[model samples]
Target: MGGGIQWQQNPALCNIMQEPWEEPDIPDVEAPTPRRALTCLSDEDSQKIYDSVPRTEDVFNLHRGDLELHEKLGAGNFGSVMKGVFRRGGQLIPVAVKTLKQDELPNAESELMKEARLMANLQHRNIVRMIGVCRSDMIMLVLELAPLGPLNKYLKRACGRELTMNKVIEIMFQVAEGMAYLESKNFVHRDLAARNVLLVNEQFAKISDFGMSKALGLGNEYYKAESAGKWPLKWYAPECIYYFKFDSKSDVWSYGVTLWEATSYGAKPYRGLKGCQILELIENNRRLERPDQCPPGVFDIMLRCWRHDKNDRPSFRDIVELLRKFRSKS
Candidate 1:
């Protein structure tokens, strides 16, 4: 009557309806636990991650107390290089201690370590050597002392009266040799200039300041910088200025400017010209004129280095060979 199914009032139907429905048994199984995603790591966790990687053997750590800093040799915005004595193995050896200012330490430690690591791997008479590193209260790079100081300042102090054509050629040859070694190691000295080169004496020159240097990866011919800043525009090649590309060829271009500096007795390249004017000059295929003291043959080398086409530039190896012949003739 109510539109529902009715059971028959029979014995079998009534017995079946009177009985309750039974549920089938199901096996109980546990659900898998969810993994927590790590959005940030704690200091301890970060240290643990790096602890798995092996340390580089090139870094030789030294005790900070062992170094006695004396006179400040030079100072810059980030740090200073001071004359120091390093006591090791019962020997007191004179060294240059490079330290970052307290105010700049937060942002400059990585760069200082990078410079130390690069210098440690390099072993050449014409390349500055890293004695060791100190990471105690502050980061310090102990380096072999170049008593004569920067080549640019040394040249300016000499002022042409002390340096002869032969001496200048010899200095250039030594720098070329250092650059050749760097090239063989696949290292590019992005800041190759007279100011970056240091001298142990008038006859011996070593390339220093690897903060801007880069080691090219295997099979890579060039490195691309991520950002533009206060770069040495006058010493840079066209490709470097435009595309931020750097390679051995760019170093050659800087070397040409450095040669000009040496021949001109530390005269600034593109003097009095602003960065934009220098860029315009380069875009128009114009270059610095030859210095009065620079020989025609040496100036020819500079021209070859400043070729508009990077591929047309000579390799450090070729320049070294050419300089060798020139030195012999001089």
Candidate 2:
């Protein structure tokens, strides 16, 4: 206590000790905002997302009242094709309307929409053009009318009237050209039978019914069906019959069968054989023989298309070239 009293008596030492310490002030800084979490999609989820979006290609959406339904042209498992008039831009245009049967709507809508979308994108002289689509209480695809109707029916009628060989060849040549276009676009028309070919006039043929066409670009040379249905066993290739695999090569094989139908004047392929029998025949390395009056060169082309090994089958381009040469020779 006596020593501490000595420091209080010293003025300079007391002033230093009694001074209070001062601290510097700091400005506040804001914290950064947190980011939201991201989600990874599975393949199936990605496909569903893709399917929900509309294609960039122009597709007309129409109202139900715009179309006036007329006589039915044909009927199929999914729907009916009828001759109709579409009121467009103050003018009535004749069109073929494909209407979904109400009872099948729940199960068939996706397929119908897919077909409509595909047809809308395709624009070729030898491919049917979709005009517009009406998605009201039911789905209706308005398409350009092919006045002469399907090739199979036309062939039958022409046969009865004794049509010329050159005329028949001309029709098939157009089909080959259409197929070549499809090949160039990487589209595989799984159903390439005569019934699916439509005629704009008596001489011109267009490939239609793209419900089974598959666009290839995803490292797949073929499409394997996920489920079974009423497949055209007569027009299918050996591989298609056995493995359910379809590709441009399979369509070529079907084209050969369609040629058979044409040259034979719409005669049934494998006329007396059952579907199972036809499969067995093809499995045993047998193919449809030449039609009674088919030109040897034309039949040769058919043989090339019906090759047991799909790799051995000629491309549609080759088929078109050969057909042109054949036509020149004729």
Candidate 3:
């Protein structure tokens, strides 16, 4: 449902640093465990499954013959996404198939498989659903088709009809809600952006593309770029850009840029500025101005998300609450 990915890199581990919210006064609440796939296996086998691609019993092991590949949807560094239909139980189900490029490094293939495993655990209404996996010479992930495709493209096309403020709020609100769910599970969507958000039936927004997402842990908050991976510079928080550090708070910073995209009706963030130039502007404390049609309340939330100090950024839970308030007012 989304596309235009660049260079990829495996996450690098870093030194442990306590999060601001994980204070001494407040006990650290245990992160939520992802719903495990139904599988009957020994502990040793389960450990092996956890280490590699775990078989999801609930999800189908889609055979190649069952899938009818149609038009190409989009392409990324790892591979391409295609529109396809899965024949199951005498029913045809529309699906999106994300294939791993055969030419990519073996590590890339493994990473994509791991991403599928992660997606299998994540089952939320606002998040794209992974229906199954096809593991042959070529690996493919079967996902629910987002009829309207990417949010950015959808917004651009919305010129035919007014992209109302309430709609924008609702779209961003869905993203925030999905992100809040991820945060609760200690998953950091390192690549959160408007382009990564997809729309189902042009009404329901769903977060997609978890290839760049990471499960946060001690000494894992900051991902040191192993190679020269292409990051979303404009959407990155200062800490993420300058130090390669990322967490839920950094995700909030990206969410702010996404809000800007929504408000500007899919216009590029830091338009006309190079990545380095955008970094310089951000370093100088320059932030995106509120869109002409943006509400003051919404703009205020964006400002809070873009706080220079990551600790100063509002939690996704807080952001969700603020969005609900705005929606209620509307």
The top-ranked prediction according to lDDT is: 1
lDDT for position 138 in model 3? 85
**lDDT (CA) for every model shown?**
0.74, 0.72, 0.73
Q: Which ten residues in a row have the lowest lDDT in candidate 3?
A: 14-23
Clashes of each: 0, 0, 0
**Clashes in model 3: which pairs?**
none
Residue 299 error, candidate 3, Å: 0.7
Q: On a 0 to 100 scale, what is the lDDT of residue 88 in model 1?
A: 62
User: Which lDDT tens digits does candidate 3 get at residues 274-312?
Assistant: 655565566577899998888898999999998888889
Order of candidate numbers by TM-score, starting with the best: 3, 1, 2
In candidate 1, where is summed lDDT lowest over 10 consecutive residues?
30-39
What is the C-alpha lDDT profile of model 1 across 1-330, one tens digit per residue? 210122233333233324322111212432222122211334244223323323345336877778899888776435888888877657566677888777845768877778778878887778877777888777888887666677777676777776776788898899999999999999999988888888665666778888778789999999998655446667888777566689999999999999988888877787666555666577677889988878888989999999978899999999998778778555
Ranking by lDDT: 1, 3, 2
lDDT of 2 by residue, 41-122 (tens): 3323322322332434333687787889988888755689988777755756667888887685576888788888777777
Judge candidate 2 against the unseen true structure and give its global Cα lDDT, from 0 to 1.
Answer: 0.72
Candidate 3 residue-wise lDDT at 39: 23
